[model samples]
Target: MDKHELAAFLRNRRDRLQPEDVGLTSGPRRRTAGLRREEVAVLAHISTEYYVRLEQGRAPRPSAEVLAGIVGALRLTDAEADHVHLLAGTPLNHTGWHRRDVRPSVLALLERLPQTAGFVMSAAFEVLAWNDLAVALMEDFAARDPEARNLARRAFLTDSPEEGPLYGISDVTEFRQNVVRELRSAVARYPSDPAMTNLIDDLRDGSAEFARLWERNDVQPARMLTKTFRHPIVREITLNCDELHIDDGDQHLVLYSAAKGSPAAESLAFLDALGTESLNSRRR
Candidate 1:
């Protein structure tokens, strides 16, 4: 178990709750920003001393029942509760690294997707494979060095003013938050992966925004059903986003498509016909 992280997570959650939030009276002269440690302990049915130690990172791994009590006491969201379980429970075996390879069948599937911009993203947010239309809609991933293909890096580390915000997608802030949340879970799952650890460290050290969001201790991502891309070729095109989890490899097949006969659909078809070469030339 990650004792320190669990402690920090609990403390952060505890600090966000008000006394009345838990149906407790805000006694006069209350000085604390949120509920006190003692208040949390009382609500969790644990000793004040124990809860204090848990927050201080000195307590042993909490029992499942104790964790459940704390979860209730903190009023953590479903995602936050899962994060608590992950941090408090015995760590998963870190024997293998997160997979980066796309299954051949999945690669072929990307090619077969008609009128869709399709790509496979690894757990680390690397664009592992892409269809022709994906290249036209997004950047030409094949031309980028493998490290540059990482969406997380593109989300935060892109220093070029010309690059705009990650494919000029309309939801940069939300995307960055989701990236941080997903990476937090990824790092925990792959504690031994230098690549994973290093990637997160780089992001945290390089981007103040990333560091701030990381401290929020969020684990869940808000669902984004559609996305808008401000493409040089087609201008603004909105597409329905469908994410298919390749659980076997811990990858995702992301497809961006529009409803048939929609303006966005016409734009996608035009981009597909133009292809990557034409798109690249236009950018140049």
Candidate 2:
């Protein structure tokens, strides 16, 4: 690792951004031109002392995960991310591997589950693919900007809808924490991917809630269980959330199903018809 280059890069990135750019409020009386070292350390989930050491070129070689965190914290672009990886001596070619595709079998499974709300997501919570029912119950992924299709991005970075449909559950705190924890895992797995790093940077800069949750440094296995949603058309429905991990692609097939003959099941059927109509109208 090029210690001098790494230190210079870290300092330069840190000096370019302001607090507001990262969802932090600038104090009434500010002395520094950019973000404080402590702020960067908090965003990167590292100690201020260690970050100081890094900036001074006195620290030991950082692990891939640490490099990833710093990359995200600094809002490094794709090229910059690669440069940081090289400086850390853990370079991995991330070109063309940034986004994973949904398998044909997974698409077939989604097609077969007409009454269920299902979608495929990447480790970074990017919506790779989704069924019509998912659109009916939540915002239309196809209609959103490609970058805006991420669950974590929308949940924390943007304002929650006032009275629209709920995605997983009505308990906002639990949902946000879960998303944050899962994203932490994704950062570790795809440290060299610019897209992942960019997403993290955006989240850290745009959402104080995300920054706070991320600072907890919690890691947990994503759990699949029952969840409640307040759908605008269906009112309220409770469903079982099943997450099938695609080990090869590191993606997840998330399906929500209600018990047969239950009220939620009936609501889901109604939603299917509504979703079909919505799809047909769009084609017109």
Candidate 3:
């Protein structure tokens, strides 16, 4: 917790941002290189004097919420937000637990439910483990390069098939926003992990849409929702996506299922049969 480093970092970030960047209009006679201290305070919902004290290295340690507001106001990148938390002596998760392995029990659960498409994802959204049905429904995680297995990276960083169905409906803006919001928390939670850092850096560099959304600083916890996937074979299938959180490991077991007796359920069963047939053929 170096006060000097924190002060300097905050000042630098503030100076790099222009007024227009944060929805403020610069006056005709304005000559400041970036947003004024008062403007930052207003945007961050803090006192002007308190912000000044922060920049002067005289303020007490800021709470997590205050730091989050500042991060949003400054439009800092995920990496930068993590740095601020570190410098403030309030690490996002003090336990320093970043697990890449799925528990055996979790894997067994996936195996037992062959009809369901299930996968385990790290806090950083990396595909740590996935079942065959999951591969048939989504892209094959095993075949992809390790760095490309991230959900955020796949959603924003790369181009999708023009004719193939995507994760959500035709308008995927909301889905994209949700991913960005969740990734923001993930970055803070695993700041020092190389995989998380590299994924963020790549997304920021390769995707303009991603870069724009990242600045919005929207943080949301994971939620259960119904998702529609346009699988090339199954066509349009809507399934309930539920997340089982493994708190100790900071991982999630994402399972996709359709209600019994529904068309979607039938499609899932057909898809599972197809997957099995394909596996038997490869064994020959």
Q: Which stretches of candidate 1 lie over 4 Å from their true place?
A: 1-95
Quote model 3's TM-score: 0.61
For model 3, the superposed segments whose C-alpha errors exceed 4 Å read 1-97, 160-171, 221-224, 276-284
Query: In order, what lDDT does every prediction score?
Result: 0.85, 0.77, 0.77
**TM-score for each candidate, following the candidate numbering:** 0.67, 0.62, 0.61
Candidate 2 runs further than 4 Å off: 1-98, 160-168, 278-284
Give the higher-TM-score candidate: 1 or 3.
1
Total residue pair clashes for candidate 2: 1
Winner of 1 and 2 under lDDT: 1
Clashes of each: 0, 1, 0
Q: Give the number of the best model, judged by lDDT.
A: 1
Question: How does candidate 2 score on lDDT?
Answer: 0.77
TM-score of 2: 0.62
